[model samples]
Target: MRILKTRQYELVEAKDIPDPFPPYAILSHMWLSPKEEITYQDFKSRKEDIENDVYKQTGWAKLKRYCDRAARDGWDWAWMDTCCIDKTNPADTQEAINAMFRWYQNASICYAYLGDVDAYGSLEEAGLIDQDHPMNEDLDEMPGMIPVPGAATNHMRTAVGRSLVNAKWFTRGWTLQELLAPRYLVFMDKSWHRIGTRESWAAEINEASRIEPKHLTTFKPTDFTSCSIAMRMSWASSRYTTVEEDETYSLLGLFGISLPLIYGEGRWRAFDRLQRELIMVYTDDSIFAWKLSETNQGFIRLQRQGQKPGLGILAPSIREFRDASQIQSFGYYGHKFEMSNLGLKTNARRWKCHNDHTKLLIRLNCGPEPKAHTGIMLRYAGEVFERIMDSELHDTRNFERSRDWIGVQEKEGKDIIIRAGNFRGPLTGPSIFTLRHPDEITVGLKYFMDFNVPLMSRKLELLDEVSLLGRLQLQRNELLLQPNQLMFANIELQTGEHQSRWNVLININENGFPSVGMASQEDRGKQLGDPMSEAKRKYENLAEDFHDQAQSEGCLPLIVETKQGISVNVHLFPRPPRERSSETTRDGEVYIEMREYTLKIIGKEKKDLNGSKQPQSSS
Candidate 1:
């Protein structure tokens, strides 16, 4: 560490100071533009000439004045960030960054200079023109005369206060630790006038920075460990750094951990490394409890293919840790833990849905609590398995709590193992069993399916134009193609055995398949009758037509070409109603309701030109 001798205004190495180092003050301020701030080389070469040249630059002038003030206050030295460290040396830069918090904490006092604020001018202008004063009652009637408030008291709502709140000093990432680490920090305006101390300005600072009052008032290095990782991350959310990697590097001291600084490692990798180091030193599940936004889902999908070590279910960026209160609610207590390949293992009980198919509900062993029985919805896509919550499965707020699904407690264990299902059908290495915090995992599996299906279909359209064109021809022949020219399945429901056909408009849902009868048509509005029987007949006819068309074209009609030129089978099925009813309408008029038809794109399958089955693509 290097300290500046206040009397001489020259940089002095810490080693040069005797075994018993003298007390020193520290300058905490935002850096000036590169051209104006003095560097280490400039200070070294022009040590004597600096005093004369420094006055031209605001930053150097402030530093000189800060040193002079410290000297007059009985301090031997002062440290300013702009010229104190030899930034050209990598080792020095790294060490300084790691030790910055400690330096601030050890300082006799910290002078926070706000260059934008004019302390004297603002205080005088506001203090002399108080509208609430009794003298101001007839001030409008008098010319060039106004009531003035006393200048003896300090008010935060004055012009000086506004300048202090909006200062750039409060928005820098490095300044966050600086603000918290110092024992006594004095806010000084452009004229070097003292505005307030940390204690006197705590409330205003907290309001401006959105930091918790306790953190601003009584901060310590230990405070980092006492709070949830999400809360700590939230404090840095609105703060910024000049170098992208410094956003993570600057927080090392606050987190009480340090790793070699790799400047080029981008923000994503830097944050990932930071979280990895944090998890190694602290066992807090809330560290991984980050809220997912709509944009974050895309990142999760990108990483779903293959995740890195120590990154199990962790969000890629700090932006996800937005809510500090939500993270603190978990109250996870543990210091040492490890992540296992198997997560939250449980025995699944099969339950029937309206479709008559069984869905698995995995019973989780949540610690020793007897009444805390929780079940997560288990879904399987080939060998990959996923765990979802009950809240994510359906809109259950209006319905009674059923045995179908339940929420899991986050304090169960560090590494919870979840069994995929009963049949150990072809285990694909180690299955990824992930269970995110309930508040963080808002969107269910249906959301991802909804978001990706259309993209997949569009990609398929681009990749397999030939197959899409063939499908288009079939749609055109049936007049099922919309006016927009998009290919869709036609649902022709036959009623009354007279072969009366009602043309049901098809809609492409988030699932990427054409569905019909979800919305009643104006022409069919008055015809109110159950159309399940007619829908069943229409499905059978469509299935027959599909098979015959496949046979004639020497290619499966169900097989659609993907963007990668892979053939995927599309299945048409009837969607079960929320509640089944057999009662016909009072007038006995038959009508088709929307949402009757459902479509799904299954796994890829290849078929030869001769209609013989061929090998499918791995993807």
Candidate 2:
């Protein structure tokens, strides 16, 4: 990233710049960029003139909206030359140009305002000024500088002058190199084309070409008539542009291919203008070969790597009106109707005749023989049938717009009925229809099954309509099937209402809880068929085994135990819950009685029978 050392210069204010004269109206407002810097000396030099210029200061309000939007967007910042950079000094201007490449590289995006597409003036018109001006005599017929009141005379002959004039195509607010180097460029007007203004001027070359044809020459003023005729003939097969072709051609070189016709029309002209005239398209991968017509004959030939050559006829012509329409046919005396092979000088089967209005006839070679067939025919039915449907899938009386359906007949043997929004009229050629949800989906389902019903020859239409139907149906289903929502399925019994093409229900012979067949040993071995009961039994047994292990691990009780006291035939019965709690709390203190008992004997066993305590503590 090369940057110029910042010079120790005074910062100049934007108000100080000299204003352009009244006759020279600004086509586009200026902007400043963060990439540039300004100085005091620069501002002071232009301050007096800029302050006096009423138009620059007064009309600034018009730019407020644009400035506000740009600021909000963040992608674009103001980069107007007048406001953004200090251009008063020659050193500053030179430094700015040198730093342009780095500046553009750093920018996220470039906004190229083409201004008004129609507001452009020709180079000749830009030079025009009134003969009655006070300094008219002092100024040359061409572009030149005249004396200013408080500032040095600004001349158009300088290198900077050339840049200012040529810059309108790219560099005015930006240098040409800077404009080209940006990461991305957005044209403000969607329709603004970088191609040259006139169909002829656009054809000029901005870059060099590699494989330029040997016999090619530049275009002259005389090639218009033949080119137009050629274009009308081939218009059906190819997409050609009448606007100048050179700019696109020049930009192509950035991709990496080279165009060779960087030389002049004749061998005698200087090479400098020649380099600027012819188009050179080079790309990173593919190389396209081009051949220009000799003697300014208004034609170009383009050929891709593996395809047959194509011809591009240029408008504006010279003499020797050759038929630019179709490639010349074969034979020595002139074979206008038949195709001749210029490369092989023999008859070729690939060539076929085509007419603008007539149905296209194509002939192909098949296995050493030629087979002929008539293609599908789709003709307009001359009337459009329209209808509208409601949410209930019933028809509603709506405005019927008619459009010609091509060879289509509805159930009534009339033109296929198409229902859309407010339009109900005859439609032919190309027409678009907009429809709401259910109708769109219903139509899509119908078309998906039998699109041939709408036309003699089928071509798919209504993709957006089909997509809308899907979205609408999904939304409806979502609403219908909400959580805990109740819905009814219309079910019919087999013997009653279920006998139809779509649904079937069967009744079993043996009923009453649906008998689970029990298999006997004889039935199992003798092929009578084992019962499902056998499988269920095995499953239950396995489940019990698993449950036992699980219960033991989980501290679950699987057995009950009873303990007996045996000394001298004394027996005690279990106490109830209330009695046990009372006994456990007999001491007037809270206590928990153990559900399981642990034995500890301290009294004599004989006391139980006697109902009194004997001397023996235990038996």
Candidate 3:
């Protein structure tokens, strides 16, 4: 460990642990810009370099004032990062990073400097704070110095409280350990003036860092890595490091790992190594509980498991675990994961998704409760299992209470190795979709309409353009449906001698959203009375239906599954209304709506809609 002689500005090297070390103050802060900071090499040449008023700059001023503050408290030694370690030497840098947590832990006191915050807040009475004020003196000899003990009074708290809430010190990658490992810490503003001690400002720190008050104030070394890895990663999700690799490097001490540091490896690769290290050492399966943050797109919006892109078992970044800080881990003991050239292999319960063979859920051994387990969405790809994070088809708000289709059942224990690091072979996936619409309707006709059909991927076109089961008269229907799910148009079905007359109504609103709904023979009859009534209903534009179309009358989802079981889910987007006009017949009857006719034929692995091929859109 290296310490600075505060009184003489001399670097003192302590090669071995001093039996009874002198009390030393440590500085915990983000580094200034490159040109502003004083490095260890800068001090090796001359003792007079800091004199001649050359150390008046912000970076030098911070160090000088910190030393002054330590000396003011009657301590002769103080330590800081910027000028302490010789970073140019790789071995020295590595050892320093590995021991940083302990260095902070052993400190008698730590000064947390927030460069973006000010001790004096904006005064409403005056426009702005005057630059020339009794700020903390930059050197011990400077006049009009701020008081030392109990300096942050009620006026300082009122001024510094709001600024502390969003201090940049709380959002830096390395500060996480600095904030937790220190025995005693005090927050200092930009001018190095005392704001408050860590104990007195625990609430403000908790509000800023999302760390519990106890974690900030208590000296609990045993409790450091007891938290789940996912929870620890979440704390740094919103934080940033100047060099991205430091994101993983700074967290080494927090996880109790001492692997050699690779400064230039990309962030994800570093994180990948860290995760692999963690898996080898600990049984916390909470590492797998991350998902992308929530968004506006919700229920019924489906994307087939095959259509969505695949992910490795590991998350790409810490940000993916945004809301995972509070979750607890039950531990995945007894299930030892083995990593090989193939990938990570583990034996655990693999539950099949209801009615969907391609999709499965892997249990996570952590959640709010033991029985309340969370499952990550996984799909069986060409030769290996891949994770699914982009598709809403598998999205579940609460895994504990998700629907059967969204949840998993029928668990079978299997030892599977998901493809990851071994990427010499292709991470295989198929690019094919087949949509088939049945001409005949059955009692489970809604199932046909919602799944294994082309209804979901139908292309919109004028009714006069294509020919299908021709439009039929309503005869006598009297149901007045909402604008969202009104019976807009119809396609006649096979009316066999044994079968009752049945038809499927397709609703295409002005926003271009399509709904394939099947009403019962009785319900269909009560919709529109005659052909004239149908034309009138269509001519009316049914603008009222577009007002608040939450319930799509008999809206059934369209899931297109091919012969090979590759599914294609239609993302029905309600876009802005487009200008539309219909044709009027010679008999004084005008065309009311349009039906998108998408004809698809299954190819070897892919399919062609009609003679031409079509691709489905994603949400």
Candidate 4:
């Protein structure tokens, strides 16, 4: 039976230990951890003392004990810088350094305990740290300054200056030729020790196996060779190496790993890096191993169980991985950020427009903002108003409208009349429009009628003719309502020498409706008129039925069914901020200065014609 020695756990005077151990004890146990907590600030402040204590108090025996247990637990391979060889003792350090290649050749695995295990795991999960690659890839790679790996080797060797074998000491024995040996490079987080709970490591190990079974392993005595199972264990370092060697080795082995290889010029592509990383998942035919280079900067490689180890490759950056994912949830550092739903960027903007009285048309420049979609709002203001006038305002206030099949049958020789059907009145004229602001009224008429109009209607025809006027002639809806075209009509009335002419064109204002269009009411009597009352009435009835059914069934009403309830209002009576000031700006500027608006349709219970119903709030 193997005699496993246990240390005598006894509290001793700080002065009983060596010079560095005394101070180290004071800093690590006394100042840093005084019964309650360990403050990083205090630890950093006493870093020197901490280092001294680490060097003095940490002996080879402790490391050797851990190594023996680790081996017994079926961890055939181990790589603790302190226990792997002697460092403080120069002769032993050199001897271990020379035999590193051979040591790894014989060992089945290598485990690196980076002080902060949870942090290491997080960095790896986030793709911030890397391992299993040479520390430095190129000297001329960094543009402004020399590129250096974030962490150094046990010998304090800079990543750039260290030879390939020494730089990749963590993965030294892994060669393409020695493919038969099942080698693993494991990273044990040091943070696990400082953590108060015991379940962290166990949870991590279990979760890795559960979620990523291919990446994790648990040790058991029965499992060996191609089917060997092993659980990593702790041991003392003294048996593995001398006191002086363990002391010096501990310091050099403290850092993580990195790679600096450049695959392409400019920037690396995400897909390419992903493909590379995926390929590296397979090591040998029977076995495979993976390691994080540094915290998150290394690449992974897999070889056949009996293959010779190849040179280490650099790990791709996180940015590259995200790009490679091609998923909508993958966001970049700048420009487009990923949204939660589809990985696509949510930077896309939307603007909607509607006219309370008639058809709203808008024109925009094609320069800076690319033109994506164009829409016209044929509102139901007239029908809504009718409902209000009939004392049925409550019924229509929270009404939902649906899309009605619209047709524009042209009446030959008849001019497109703006005030048609229910909207005709004595005072109002056929609303004409022009892209330009009216300097003088050329054509005019009298009559104003309020009624709902179809999206494609005589109203739009009249608007097209009015806007084209003397400059351009338009015959069909397709010709006049092109994307990004503006429409407004010129109304002129001459009274002696001083002429009075105002443009009373269809409110083809901006990207949205004017506030008045969405306002509940101008006064008690006045209400917004709908354009397509017949269609709107039908749609509203259907929507009401659907809404009623949804309410009964406990379901939310689909907003799409609530057609023209969405309307844009442009208040002409209340002077706008731009118009309030007598400043002559560009026509585009004036349109932009006008208050834009929209209506959020709301749903309510269907009103019974005979039932006593509560008054509905106007919105």
Best by lDDT: 3
- TM-scores for every candidate against the unseen true structure: 0.55, 0.20, 0.59, 0.17
Prediction 2 TM-score vs. true = 0.20
Candidate 3 per-residue lDDT, tens place, 101-208, comes to 989888898988888876554322233336565545332232212234555444434445677887888888999999888888887777766666787676677788
Q: What TM-score does candidate 3 get on C-alpha atoms?
A: 0.59
Between candidates 3 and 4, name the one with more favorable TM-score: 3
Top TM-score: which candidate number? 3
Residue 525 lDDT (model 1):
37
lDDT score of model 3? 0.57
Expressed as tens digits, the lDDT of each residue in 326-400 for candidate 2 is 221111221111111211011112111122212111111111111221111111212321111111110111101
Model 4 agreement with the true structure over 368-423: per-residue lDDT tens digits: 11222111122223321011011000111112221322222223212111111111
In model 4, the runs with Cα more than 4 Å from the true position are: 1-204, 209-269, 272-619
Ranking by TM-score: 3, 1, 2, 4
Instruction: Sort the candidates on lDDT, descending order.
Output: 3, 1, 4, 2
Model 1, C-alpha of 83: deviation from truth (Å): 1.6
- Which of the two candidates, 2 or 4, achieves a greater lDDT against the reference? 4
